[model samples]
Target: MKLNHSVTGQDQGLPIMLVHGLFGQGRNLGAIARRLSEQRRVILVDQRNHGDSPHDPDHSYAAMAGDLAEVIGAFGGRVDLAGHSMGGKAAMHLALTQPELIRKLAVMDIAPVAYAHSQNHLVDAMAAMDLQGVVRRSEADRRLSEHIHDTGLRAFLLQSLDLKSDPPRWRLNLPALRDWMDRTTGWPEGLPKGIFDGPALFMAGAESDYVDDAGEAAIREYFPQARLLRIKHAGHWMHADAPEAVAETLSAFMGGG
Candidate 1:
């Protein structure tokens, strides 16, 4: 599959790829990439079934990992990788499956263990929107508010909604994503064996339950060199909540500072 991506700082230094979570596109990390662009080549990728990437009914960590591998290969061998939530899991799988293709790995606010399907409400809310009759983004926002309580989350999800001049179209493949919510949330079982010895950083939001004691063993099993860092007062979206901290940590890690 030809993965969709936006490249920044291409001529600066070593390449670093940014992968976003579920319901997120490459641009979600635009800020971080721009900040890091001063010293590194940043590649923000939109994983399959999301953003402008090709949509397929099958969405799994293995498939997503394969997609990432292809992107890395296109970059001329290995590159540093950073991912959040769902993207974090896929990054881990990719590093483990193709260790030689990843220079360094950073996983934000997500564990390697299998996550239970908890985003069903969000999926249902997104699916319930009357896309056909929706006249404006505000109208869609108003209707979505009934099902989604968090105004911020509603706005974040709605970022996928793009209005084209030619008859207006929704860029995201909502139905396909909604139908494979389980696959998107689930973890791949079993590994080929051994660990990815490359330097790895496991960043967790202080207030997020995504990375807890329960998932530590699984993380260590695959990424034995992984080091954990917690950003204060942040939730699942640590990068958005604490951009400065994330940028500092990432810059240091990638630059070997």
Candidate 2:
């Protein structure tokens, strides 16, 4: 599917594509994109089933990676790809399956291994939300609060709420996400055995357990040239917690330095 995307910066060398995580849109990485765009073109992509992208029943990493491949080919044959969380996994899968499409790969706060955590609760909360007579984001927030206590996370999810659409509705495909929860948090079986020997960056948040020892091992197994780094005082969403650091580090990784 042709995913929704926005491009900035000059048509210089290979573009840098930024992909967001679950429950996030491309604009979530706007800060990083802005910094990188100064040196090269940046493609902010709304992965399928999120943002303005077309939603499909399949949300597997392979499918997601395929969607990204389409976007990359449309912009240019090759790109320097960076993705956070779910987007990071998709980026890795693309690089593994089709290395020619990627000039460099950056995986932020994620590993190529399956995670035990389940985001079904968030999907359930969003699915159970009563949009009836709710005209304001606050009202929706108030209802979602019963299930989700994290104020920041609730606010983040609320970004996808379409308030102008008559009675209002979430732009996310909650059912598809919930149904495909396992695949969303899993690494596809029988992946390509070969490694992506291109320049790779595996950045983890110091406070985040997303990329643990096992994750680091997996990184080296698949990307021998991978450079590992950790952002201080940042959690899983390092881009938000330390936008400047994330942006600067990513800019340098993509050769913006």
Candidate 3:
């Protein structure tokens, strides 16, 4: 599947591709992408079934990784890759299966191991939302609030809701995401734990348990050269929680600083 992407900076050096997490569009990483684009080419892509990309039923990492491979191939077949959450898994899978396609890798707030948690509840909330006659975002927010209490998360999720359409609708494939929640939250079974011996950085949020000791060990097992860093005063959404710090850390790492 061809992803909808936006490029920044000049055609110099290996381009860096930024992939966003679940329910997020490529623009979610706009701050980091813009910062990194100052020195290198930055490509922000919307994975399949999200943003303006084509919607498909399969949301497996293998399929997501394959989609990313196609995008990377278009940009000289190699790239410095970074992904958050689900996107992180996709990037890791790509680096493991097609090591040559990645020059350097950075995974945000995630590990190579499968996670037990699922984001299906959020999908259900969105699916249950009443978009009928929802002429404004506040209406949708009010309806979603019945199920989701987090105001911030509700806003974030609403970013995918298009109010300009004839009837307000979500850009995300809610059905597919809900159906494939299990696969999305898991690592592919039976696949050999291949290694990616490239420069890899696993940036974890200091307040987030997404990358714990076990997660760090798993990361090193797959990427021996992986360096782990923890950003202060941040949670799972570390980039948004600490944009400058995350951007600086990524900039220095990608520049071999």
Best by TM-score: 2
Q: After superposition, how far is residue 67 of candidate 2 from its true place, in Å?
A: 0.7
TM-score-best of 2 and 3? 2
Structure candidate 1, residue pairs in collision = none
Task: Please give, for residues 33-124, the per-residue lDDT of candidate 3 as tens digits.
Answer: 88898899999999998998999999889999999999999999999999999999999989989899998999999998878999999999
By lDDT: ranked, best first: 2, 3, 1
Candidate 1 residues 127-215, lDDT tens each? 77666766678887888898998989988998887654243445667777777777677677777535688889999999888888977
* Residue 204 local lDDT, model 2: 96
Off by over 4 Å in 1: 10-12, 133-135, 165-169
Give me the runs in candidate 2 sitting further than 4 Å from their true place.
none
Candidate 3: clashing pairs of residues: none
- Candidate 2 local Cα displacement, residue 209, angstroms: 0.5
- lDDT of candidate 2 over 1-257, digit per residue (tens): 99999999877889999999999999999999989989999999999899999889889888999999999889767899999999999999999999999989998999989999999999999989889888888998999999899999999999999998988888899989998888889888877744688899988999999998998888888788899999999999999999999999998888852
| lDDT for each candidate structure | 0.83, 0.91, 0.91
The TM-score ranking, best first, is: 2, 3, 1
Give the clashing pairs for model 2.
none
Please give each candidate's TM-score: 0.93, 0.97, 0.97
Q: Give the TM-score of candidate 2.
A: 0.97
